[model samples]
Target: MVRRRLFSVNDHFYQGKPRYFIAECSNYSCFCVHVEGVQNTSCRSYLLFFVSKQRRLFKFIQPRTQLVATQCGVVKRIFFSTGELSGDLQGSILIRALTREALSRNVVVKVRRYISRVVVKSQKTFQLYGLGGSLMKQEGLELLQDTSKISSIGLIEAVPHLWASWSMIQNAIERVIEDPPDIAILIDYVGPNLQLASKLRKIFPGLPIVYYIAPQEWVWGYANQKVPFLLRYVESIGEICDKVYSIFPAEHAYYQRHQIASEYVGHPLFSSDWKKGNETNQKRARESLQLALDAVVIALVPASREQEIRYILPIMAQAAKHIQDQLVDEDVVFIVPCSRDDFRAKIQQQLTRSGVSQFRIYDKTSSSIVIAAANLCIMKSGTVNLEAVAMQVPQLVLYRLSNWSAWLGRNVLGLQIPFIASPNCVEMRLVVPELVQENATAENVSKAALNLLRTKHEQQRMLTDYERIAKVLHCPEGTSRAAKSMFELMQTD
Candidate 1:
């Protein structure tokens, strides 16, 4: 007689507290963990933390496991597509929250993820696969596309990368049709993401599409007469787009006319567990970097892509020089936190070429540490600005584009951006001084930085504005709002 396989949860141990439990199967390919009191009393959530055969760790997916594993329902497959770095970051936060709600009785979520994968046996696991980067990978996201296109507003400039972007779209469409995830989440990659959605909607007519951090469809899609088509495919959105949707008022409106779903759970940046250091942590960061307490630390957050390095970093160089020339006696250290490794050498090289050596370039520097040390930040208009605000660091936000790019957006695309930074856009006021295009010069940026540096009032005003912005932007329920909406829509009869 041969030893038979045990079908039950062969072993279980409470990792930390009494109620929380991790149940391991005899085969060891499948696993489940329960954290009691994590969600509301109406339901219980479970996490699938099993490693696949490939050693890819699929983080927390709520599925029927453990006690009622036999009777619990099947795992819902969520197709996620995050186009830019910010989207990837936001997607990670949203994923964790959703997984937690499946188990959390109290709704509080702790996001922790080196997630690898192995073979997942016949177990109900909410499978999450998408097109994203490291943050998603850390959450065990099976990134579909390798092309991380950092798109900019430029017809001539962005043409070279169009083929690569198209390839990504094709891959996404092929995957959706072939495997066909139960639902799809499209982050702010307007071109490829929208194309993928359009194709998936046609192939899988009822497949739900969630556009998290949904882009300005009015300008990019509607103005071009493409949005109305894409809108038909979208089933949900991560943000409120009534104001944006209203722009295309056909009076007899279609999908673009109605509000899909808004998470309003506050900005994902606020929900992020990436914390700024307290006085102690700040002090430690300063000491480790050998930065003085009185030194004026200016963080230069340039870009995550090549174009930004080519165009934006040079402007930063000029601005830094001007700032140095103006504040002759004040001690300053220009710290650059390079977003991508490909541009790290280039950033250092450019700084060196500019003969600016009173600087430190860190490829993997923590944004929190940089924010903690810096009195002010000179950054490109991106997700990093949100990090600056959360850390209570005053900034002179800036952006520059080639004449061709500027023409492309203004003349060709007919885009009217009131504010590039999200905070400024929130209140319809320039919460921070933003200089763009021709206005973004070394002189203008230095003057702005100097004014903010000299006046304590300006800094305090920013802090005050930040508080107001937080109140307007932060959601107490966190990313769970988005996650819950997605699940409820999927589970609806």
Candidate 2:
């Protein structure tokens, strides 16, 4: 006897309406039947059952497994947590990479806002949502909270935002528990990210947590007393994260020594998105800024944080004035690329007060173009240092903090490192001149900038070092590699 059974195999939305697919199974065969007019609730069950107890005979149904998986909403949901402007930039790139990788795997991805009921409509395979800023949002990251403006560097600088930061952490924990992700990616922004990792591990013990651009705890063990602190930090990371992707080779080795699951993916700055600067780019950048081809351009990149601006921009302005005095015979123009829109008025006021002439401030311009057009970049010691290296632009890196914060970091935290600039750190030597803390004065900055401008040998030596740094960070399509690794991790489970 040929018995028949109807199985509601697939139920999903088409356009704005519900669509269902029914699989009719007999003792001899099984076939799918499209039922657009049927309501999802009208189906008795979603499961497929065999009345003949001859499931091995249903070989044709094996090919439909992929379709069933897709229709059943079996997607890898990735949660990304990042903060600060730099984090936002990195997160945005990673998000795009993730989307592209998913599409290549024949998956559909969707982004859903953390707080809003509305979901971002798309035809991708992964569901991405987390904490980020406008840039990440633009790349289809459903931001839980916008954290681009809530950044601080030092212990003292973070005091005012402590309460708000704590509240954000609590909210993040609550949301994750509500709809736990298949995988969680935590970018830089150490404190909050580390906290989130620890909490998520306890709440969802099996959830895979990956850390990208991890904190530089390995570089902080200058004193013997700090070794324990460094060990503790690395241990916490190992305990919390299932995988850690390091941008620096030395950092990757450090994590490996401590028995952490880590891989060196190189820096995202060296990814395909940013091409190495050449004469063509330099000429175009100069033209875009309306500068003469023969004119010497000095680019100034201050810190992205407000506190950093207060401690650093004024000194940078004064340094620009000093350079102008020394280069009276040369047609020199200073370009200050504002990192944030809100910082423009303050930067303008500081430059005006310093009596610096023949200078222009660009608010909405790409820093890459500014660096490419520059003969020398006087900037803070951060991600921008790596950018300058990528562009082969000679730079003088400087950084400053409030007196109390500086003292606390040096004395209380016992924070000591050989190099602050990213290029020097990667090279394990001072490839670029760094004027930090009290040494970061107008005279020191101007003197260093002028030396690089006047001495071709020194500039060429720096360029050579940049080439070496590039080799160290030479993983092609690094962000895509990172995304592929993430997908592999998801498949493992």
Evaluate residue 338 in candidate 2 and report its C-alpha lDDT on the 0 to 100 scale: 77
Best by lDDT: 2
Query: Candidate 2 on 1-493: residue-level lDDT in tens?
Result: 0111121112123223233322222242222333334444433222222223364533322211212332212355688888888888778778878888877774321112223221112244566788988878988877889987778988789888888788988998887765557688999988888888889888767677999989876664421235525225787888889889988888888899889998888888887744532223678889987888899999999878889789999999999889899989999888988778899889988888988888888863367788888988998988888888888899989999999988977777666767888888776678899999999999999999999999999999999999999998978888888898887766621
lDDT value for model 2: 0.74
Candidate that would win on TM-score: 2
List, residue by residue over 201-282, the lDDT tens digit for candidate 1. Answer: 6665555666666555433233234443423334433221221111112211333344543334467676643331223345
For residue 254, model 2's alpha carbon misses the true position, in angstroms, by 0.4
Q: Which ten residues in a row have the lowest lDDT in candidate 2?
A: 1-10
